[model samples]
Target chain A: MSNWQWFHRLGSPRWFYYKTEGWVPWLAAVSGILLVLGTVWGLAFAPPDYQQGNSYRIIYLHVPAAFLALIGYYVMAVAGAVGMIWRMKMAFVVMKSAAPIGAALTFLSLVTGAIWGKPTWGTWWEWDARITSMLILLFLYLGIMALQAAFQSRDAADKASALLALIGTVNIPIIYKSVDWWHTLHQPATLKLTSAPTIHSSMLYPLLTMILAFYIFYALVLILYTRAEILRREGRTQWVIDLVKEEAKKP
Target chain B: MHPVRRQRLFFILFIVFFSSVAVGLMAFALRDNINLFYPPSMIVAGEVPLDRRIRAGGCVRPGSVSRDRETLETTFLLTDGIVDFRVHYTGILPDLFAEGEAAVVNGELRADGGFYATQVLAKHDEKYMPPEVAETMAAVSDGHDESCEVVQYGS
Candidate 1:
């Protein structure tokens, strides 16, 4: 089949289930390997900051987690928009699966950031613009989750949640630019397109590696959750029923 | 609502409430980050121990600045007129570090009556004040007398 033919077939629940089952284990294995390598490289091998010393090592986890949190929200919002526009049930499932994961990542970012802040900034929390905005982002995610659960009908819930996700996306750019707009204590972006990194190559290498590892881990988890969501939503279909029958027969 | 639906809603609320409390506790546990600022008089009175990491804020006393060429350490006196404390810092001074300027230093106190600073922050008034400083100013200015005049220091 052509690529477009395969793409079109993916919308079919059975086709998606069969295609993703073969890929999930490999993706999970690769994600685990990369994460371990990245952590070791960042925590042990990388040199410490001249100013912050060993405490700056937290950046390896903190920065990647924060980056993923933001990106995950965008992914969920886009998926929601697609579901709303195309009236695709699978897209809605994907959005639903992505929200909790994104919120978890956002929570992780805030926690890790606080841990890092304690040793370096001598404080656990700051109402800095970026931090405050990120907290609001978490609230938005919870709002979507709550709105979805509030409705009596599943379809109505999905539609309402999708709309909320789309509207909340307006805050993303504001969160990104808050530091520049306000006189914040939090340092400006370390990685920027216009200028070279203010860090040594030893530190930069591990940071980049950790970022790649995080992306892979995100993809791995997203695919897993998507598969689970598809199973739960499409359990009444013949393929799912047959798969369940086959499992029971094996025992 | 159905029983299952109600339970799920309760579960989510539980998570939200529990997580919020956890976050609050973490913030309180890490209160050191929020409670860093101290006046020079507090340092002199032994209210703030010299060995502990603390921030000292006051005006730099004119003619009290000296530098050691061999050690790269600089010594200066900070005063609020009620009391004064000598601050000794080793390393490059902030650009704003000069005679008669408002400054905040983060470091430990020496066995002697001086501060061995790890970080030196120079603050200017409205022109170059950080957001935190601006917020602090706003909070303090709400009902207090406005005798505190912020001076411009290094860039």
Candidate 2:
């Protein structure tokens, strides 16, 4: 029971806020460093792909954005599930905060993919299974965000968006399997969980680093957004008011 | 867990499970139309309808490319290692378009079985390596074809 205490404590807005307060700058610095290192290494050091040449370097951004866009959806769905099941206000806030970030990343993935496609595939867009499925993912994120904004009551908004988020989880597996399940213009995954990566070590290492950087960056933004939401939602509470007063009193 | 909380968790699980099943059935039902292109084998079997716009994708058979030079008229053979067909296009090809590479062509099927392509797109494989590594690989496996083996057609 004691071991699970942290889980219950995490449901508290004040506890979550103070716990993540000091982590923002640290995460920002680490993610920033990794992003710069990975980008530079991928761009300059990694050899040009034998077939595609330098255009392949965009994988550093495209793959990471696509990876996190899919992952962020699951994170949002799980948080929504927790809120719906346990009535955790913090979980609801976290779920609400994840929508725009996931949407932006999905947009980034699609744009980078288009830019990469023009030179490689000879088309800026295709109705291929993989590309269509990824576009659907962006729409799913946008739908959840729109649902959250549509309701008049906060509780109603939370429940409605949570249900939609849960239902949208169906698309995640579909997006992942679209390339394999159907003939697609897009190539199959370069990195596989079960097998060694198809890419050479020079290209794979920086890509792996960029993926890690994106995950940390996602966490950092999620925490920052959730903290702000907590403050807004809990503004009338004595704890939040006192914390604000304390901050105001400081030089 | 509290009884109400346990019930809510189960309810959420039920919703997710049923929705996924519904989506899965729809995907299975529409599987054929979902594929971006048909393999040369399917077209060779006469399964694909004629006089309609459709896509066929396969590896560009090595030594099968011939160009008109003056015009953009170019012809090459596409194969799935099981069946081979020719694709004719009259436009600039992508940079990666080459012999032994995967390509998808969209247009109509000719009476002679060749594809008259309005659009031609190159499809690369999952493998990525530097030119030096590729040269070494070519040297190590002279006369052995490894490119076409990586591409699989949708069944």
Winning model by DockQ:
2
Best by TM-score: 2
Model 1 Cα lDDT, one tens digit per residue, A1-251: 48567546756767777878888888788878888988898778876553455767788888888888888888987777666655678878888888888888889889997887665544577565678878999998898889877999989989888777776775676566655554344555677668777555677878888888888888878888888888888999888899889989995
Candidate-wise lDDT, in order = 0.71, 0.91
**Which residue pairs of candidate 2 clash?**
none
Q: Give fnat, all candidates.
A: 0.00, 0.91
Error of 1 at B154 (Å): 6.8
Colliding pairs, model 1: A122-B33, A123-B33, B50-B109, B96-B154
Reference-based TM-score of each model: 0.64, 0.96
lDDT value, candidate 2, whole model: 0.91
TM accuracy, model 2 = 0.96
Task: Name model 2 segments beyond 4 Å from true.
Answer: B141-147, B150-155
Best by lDDT: 2
